[model samples]
Target: MPLNPEIEACFEEMRDIRRHLHTCPEIGLETAGTAAFVKEQLDGFGIDHQDIGANSVLAIVEGRGPGKTIAFRADMDGLEITEETGLPYQSRTEGRMHACGHDGHTATMLTFARYLADHRDFDGTALLLFQSGEEGFGGAVKIIEDGLFEKYKIDLMFGLHNWPGHAENHIIVHPGAAMASEDRFDVTIRGKSGHASSPHLCVEPFAAVADFIGGAQSIITRMVSAHDKAVISITQVHGGSAYNIIPDEVVIRGNVRTTDSGVQDLIEESLGRLADGLASIYGVQTSFAYHRKHPVLTNSTPEPAMKAAARVVGEENVRTKELPAMGSEDFAFYMQHTKGCFVWVGNGMDSPVLHNSKFDFNDHGILVGASYFAELLKEVTRQP
Candidate 1:
């Protein structure tokens, strides 16, 4: 379907909003300025809204008639990366950038909010959720704990993320397990510290760190079934300060990503066991801390939502089948409480991949995303 003229006309305005957000990217739950800007826009539209958590905003737009109440979400967080896209309106905040296209997500939701406010043709209420800390600070959990679902009755919910490496403006709506669950771990191994020349006197931890790193990989390659998908990555290793000294302690931090909760549990248990065995063998003390970040984002029942998306982007542009991604999203938290589907809106195959220093949200997706949300509101909330 072609873009609605009204929505198409707002493209430049949305682009401007996106650029402005890109210039002043905020990280995690400290999205005060971004929330303020979003609130200002919502207030201009005369929509009813309120602040949820420290840096999240929620707006309600009641339709002309009564029907099911639906919710749509947009994440409002930036990565810790420095701006390298070199766009005229690149990040003004040093060491912070919207390399994940969150700027576009927020702008698209704002545009959809405007549409919902101006034309209340649907039957029920539409809740607009502007969330923060989706990059990994557990903002979604904070909002839920703040009584987001308890205060408001939402029958259905929906969310979108910009996907690179796909055709521009295309939509991918898989039915289940759209993304993986993220669990992070930190391991500290303590040993006797001594000079490098006194090898016999010192029980150095460098060997234990090396063995743990190598053995951690073996958990995925050997313990995990080849049919199942699991990834254990040791991204950071810290130890010795001076070349002449053997450090007393070594700290290793990494994360595990899996589609199944069972696999997640297995990896965590195996990791702890391996660390303990290594510590016993090396006569060193070891402490391991495992933290589950985000659950797997699954669209368990996506047919209705997929059809709604098809109405806006046409069936040809909607991809119903695709492999699940290893990345994780906190939108899974929302889905856990309510029935909803998370989808991907193509950011263009040639565009820079997300989280890359050069990555930027494609302006071309703003209108399409807004139009999809608008159409989805109409489809899901129509009088039955």
Candidate 2:
């Protein structure tokens, strides 16, 4: 219950900003409007900022003297989900909404930036990244390509997401992997099409598709070790249009998630092998393609985050025992270059899960998140 008084005082303004951003939801890297709004807020607070990546806004705050430069990121893009929550500040966009709570994240960062404006006596610099295109968009990659890593000498980085199914006052930090890596695969099975009545005449592709689907699950259970975690989900399957006619080709698409890179490589290799096996066994031509989207988000330094969380929310509320999420985050890309950790602040126990149509970012979370970030700034930038 002990939150930063300055951040607590800005709750109403932070709520207003969150609600305003919620009303006009932007998607992917096309967050020109959202980035503009964030820049406007930074201007009001007299913080120096500039455009980076596609439309990501990066704000710089210089401290008392030179030390470890810490960076904090907040994703600003919304999902392509229609708002079903009957809140008055519901999304005005027809097919887009802030279902993932990025609005709240941006608002919380802005509130913390406001606090930073008044208090900058600490050591080192603070980089506040109001990034766009976190929803499967290469926003983080775009920023890096645009010279984020080259221009700035960042010593440490940090980020947070509002997670459902936990208390609002609770803070969760992972000891190692915080989120999974995302890989997508597609298998195309090609065969001759012929009359359904004459089964022997046509080389059916459904048989190969079935075997591939079943074999995918085996890759997780049989190939992957029991201790290591991985998931392969067959999300899409497309085949013949007519029931009577055997299709010439059947396409199967699936998603892969894993916490370890070695496991990721194993699953991708096993899936390709399974597809090749189908070609030999079913006498059909098979093509397999795999794409690695995001890498596993491993927390290199957990002690600083854990200490900061315990400082804001009591030690009992700062959780470290929970399992790492299977969900993937683009922030993992940032961690690949620098040392940092991503923590999850509870939205609320009753809050709707992320990406749900009815999901909304809990307002109370903004206060706790900003306060935690304020404390984290102190924790990481301490004179060592």
The number of the candidate with the highest TM-score is 2
Candidate 1 error regions (>4 Å): 195-201
TM-score of each: 0.94, 0.98
TM-score of 1: 0.94
RMSD of 1: 1.9
N/CA/C clash count, model 1: 0
lDDT on C-alpha atoms for all candidate structures? 0.90, 0.94
Clashing pairs in 2: none
Quality of model 1 by C-alpha lDDT: 0.90
Candidate 2 — which residues are off by over 4 angstroms?
none
Question: Candidate 1's residue-wise lDDT over 212-253, tens digit each?
Answer: 999999999999989888999999998889989998999999
